[model samples]
Target: MPHFAATLRTGLCATVLATALLGLAGCVVISPFGGHDDQLRETTVQGDGDSKILWLPISGFISDAPSRQAFGLVQQQSTLATVTRALDKAEKDDDIGAVVLRINSPGGTVSAADEIHARIQRYHETTGVPVIASFGGVAASGGYYVAMAADTVIAQPTSITGSIGVIIPSVNAKGLLDKLGVEDASYVSAEHKDIMSPLREASPQERRIVQDVIDSLFARFVSVVKAGRPNLDSNHLAEITDGRIFAADDAKRLGLIDRIGHIDDVLALARDKAGVDEARVIRYYRGRSAPRSILAEAATGSGMNFSAAGVPIDLSVDSNAGASQPLYLWQPPGAP
Candidate 1:
């Protein structure tokens, strides 16, 4: 314990010294060490430009925190409020031509995703700017909901996209608790006081109640998908949205995505979609602790394509940085 405390103290002293040295040099910058948030990038580009292209990368499950450690990182890039502010700014800026959302994520919470979709739609309606959805490695479930707002969609040939479904996995350790000679004790003013606790398996009635909540949310997901992608065959809505992932080629066949391409391809597609022969392109990132040029995301885990607007990026382990944990709940965390 003493040794551990000494190590923490040493690390703290090193950070302080680093800061002091940088302050003295007037040019040096202290690097973020082994902290949870150090793995993500949050630099958002938000200025008036002649460019018609706007790239927004989804690097983590979006959630509802704006802390530097939460949303402001090198890996867990982008957030709900940041995107909202950027889109709002773009709408007011006549110099900005169009928007392209470069998505690479696994889906998250229904509410956050819907909020972003609504904001994108509002920006489009207000600015008369065409929004293009470009799937990076993947864009699944809630991520695709935001994409549905796009005037057109693009994806990589191998990009994993789609998974139009809702899920809220609950865990119960009551059996384990019993084995350990323990049980949870609680007092409740309402029947749902323990709704979020996993110490005990939910009763059948409780399970039904939770299912109803998820179902209502799922219906909204269906509605958004139906409303956003009109060209998609309406009959296949329920069939495709069974929380299944699709390859770009198959997705295109299903009308889930319009075409197959990468970032540069997305820019070109945006140009054609916006009818701008020479469109200036810009990207919107929240902010960056370290510049992204030196950073590259780790590889995909599952060989099968997984889709979401964003998934976690891990920076501590990768040669550069790994997938990150996002602040917004629009996407889930690395599965426990």
Candidate 2:
């Protein structure tokens, strides 16, 4: 009877936990861009019907767009896709006044980051409204790249910033596969055809080819930085080319960040620049309600069980991207 009761209790607890989690997942944030209590989304013309600040967050090694229905109640917050959608909604909203990009990311994929940055640029060119970037805890690499599009960037004194470089990872797991006794019998037409397979070693010449590609990409990164922060000394183009992070104050001193202040300060700047003292601060995250996988949820766990089976998405960080971090990146690996 005691054993049966224990089993029953365990089963009941599992059911309850699952039920609660599902309920939590159900509270999906339909649209982060949705104006507070309002039905429609579009900026108002004829001198500010009502000032609204759209908050967009770009965090972590961003992957694809988040889904709103993936979770039951609790949903994902600010993502790159959500930010883009928010800008779109805010653009047409007859009530919103300006946008405040709240950056709290260590950078993500280059193409995704570029897409966000380009959208911001488009918003700036098309709309006469002002856009400001407010840095949170840390925003480096692709994070800073996106923020550069903002008309004004505000950061706290110790905020981590910079990391302005580009790289594509090249992995050679031939030895590992050999040790595991995993033979890839798959056949390809060309001798160098197996380049896409991580099981094979990269040729010496291939290394040079990869390096050249990275160098070209790095040049592009510099070009974008120069164009965005034109006020900086553009003469010594290669001086700060190495990948590195910087403190908020140092970033400001280097002409990378505009001011040293918190998110509230940045919001004030957005309001002032948009020419409105009163406005609502809003956010947009489409399909962002999906619950994080158990493994991902426990990414911060000291003894959290992180099994490959429990993970939903495979987050990747290019090794080259880490090594080539421009001389201006702010990352706190073991920070509390």
Candidate 3:
């Protein structure tokens, strides 16, 4: 009887927890305990009008794969998926006057950034809506790459932008393996199959092959930047494209960004370009209610997660957390 009673109590508590979670309507809830609704809810963040200024974010490590949480209980939308979803909705909404991309990232994989950039470019071309990029926190490398699709890029006074280049991180563990008396017995079908293998030091030919690939990617990056910023000086191109981060002030001076201002300034510029004086500034959220402020939500693209009960389930870990691939990322001296 006691065991049965305990079982009944456990079941009742779970039922109550589920009921409480379902009843939550005025707060953002990203929970592992609940299934995600595919539908995105639109909420007016600021102003009031028939027209809308969509606030789309490109934050964290940009990747095309669905974000895998640390707990692996739920899979969140990929950065590319989020962008695609938002743009898909924007395309259907005729009242969307403009799009403001709020970017805050150190960058991610090469393909993800390129795909996002292409999507944004296509969306802008098809809709003819003025797209503006608003840099927040640290928008470097792939973050800046994705922003190239924006008609005008604006950086906050304290924002860090730039770091243009490609990086394919590699390590040589031959010495370590020798000291540990371990051997790399893995064999390849072709000589160049394991070109940049970490098991051994790269040969001259392998290094050249890798360098060629990096050079090609770098060239593409330059072309994208040139297309976006026509006013970017040719002389400054060399210095700017050398893969280094810059403050907002220097970015503007180098013509990497148009202006240094706040989110209000970005919104105002977007409004002016869209020719809307009093449009509703809005953003899409998966949860029940929109966040109180534009910055209230956590980093959008980094795969951070929280529960419906207001407990943070996953603060780190992305789908592409650890992988050897070409990336347009900015990892400072000690950055993880």
Candidate 4:
């Protein structure tokens, strides 16, 4: 009788647990779509009627990827598509009078940065909206490259703002392979075909060829800087473009940035440029068709599980596998 009672109890507990899970699942599924009309009605314009400054954030490493959705959760990597969409939305919004690009990046690919810069320029020209760049913790190389499209660039007093140069980093595993008694037997068409092969050392001639490419890209970078900051002294051009970083104050003195101020100051500058007495500040967020559920989070292992203090740990590793390419990026001290 005791064993039968125990079996009955186990069955009851399982039934209850299943019921509870079903209830939670129902809540998660229904919450996102419930009261759609009410949600639409609640969507009201922020601050005063129309005349607003759009706050567009450009954070993380810039790339031309479609989206940064990882594990079915949004990762805060700034991609070309996201930035372009934000600019398009701002351009169409009649309420938006100006744009403030809030940048906090150590730079990224040359092509991606150039594309974003071109898009911003087009948006400004098409809509006649005054765009201002507000620098955060670190804005260097391609980060600064994109900011050149803005009418004015502002940086915080302590912001690390410059590392204007190109770099093409490569790793040679020949020594490691030699130690491990592993040899590369792969065949190639020509001697210089495997230009930056990790299995072998680059020949002097190959090194010269790579240097020529770098020099050409460097000259292009110089031309862009010269055109962007026309007031920059010709004498100091070589000195500043030598792959060295600078603080915000030095950046200003060197004509890299316009002012040393915070986001509020940037907003005020945007307001003045747009000639608006009082304007609302609106931030554009990516719209979602459906809200993520706890079940989805559990299945994909999304949301924060482990953190240091209050910051979630970043487990993503950057494996720059495949061919090496030139990058207009700033590598911080001790970065691999």
Cα-based lDDT for every prediction:
0.63, 0.62, 0.85, 0.72
lDDT tens per residue, model 2, 242-299 = 6777888778777887899865677677778767876666544323232132111212
Best by lDDT: 3
TM agreement with the true structure for every prediction: 0.72, 0.68, 0.87, 0.77
**RMSD to true structure for each model, in Å:** 9.9, 9.1, 5.9, 8.2
List the candidate 1 regions with Cα displacement exceeding 4 Å: 1-51, 67-78, 285-334
Candidate with the larger TM-score of 2 and 4? 4
Model 3 CA lDDT for position 17: 56
Better of 1 and 2 by lDDT: 1
Q: What is the full ranking by lDDT, best candidate first?
A: 3, 4, 1, 2
- Superposition TM-score, candidate 4 onto the true structure: 0.77
Candidate 3 residue lDDT tens string, 1-336: 999999988986685455445434323334434555567778887888898999988888999988654344345789999999899989999999999999999999999999999999999999999999999999999999999999999999999999999999877999999999998888889999988888998889889999999999999999999999999978888899999999999999999999999998998997898797889988887755466667778333322245668866553447576577999999888665
Q: 143-237 in candidate 4: lDDT tens per residue?
A: 88889899888999989877889888788999999999999887889888889889988899999999999898878777778877888767788
Model 3 scores what on Cα lDDT? 0.85
- Misplaced by over 4 Å in model 3 are 1-32, 298-315
- Candidate 4 displacement at residue 234 in angstroms: 1.9
Q: Which candidate order results from sorting by TM-score in descending order? A: 3, 4, 1, 2
lDDT of 1 at 65: 43
TM-score of 3: 0.87
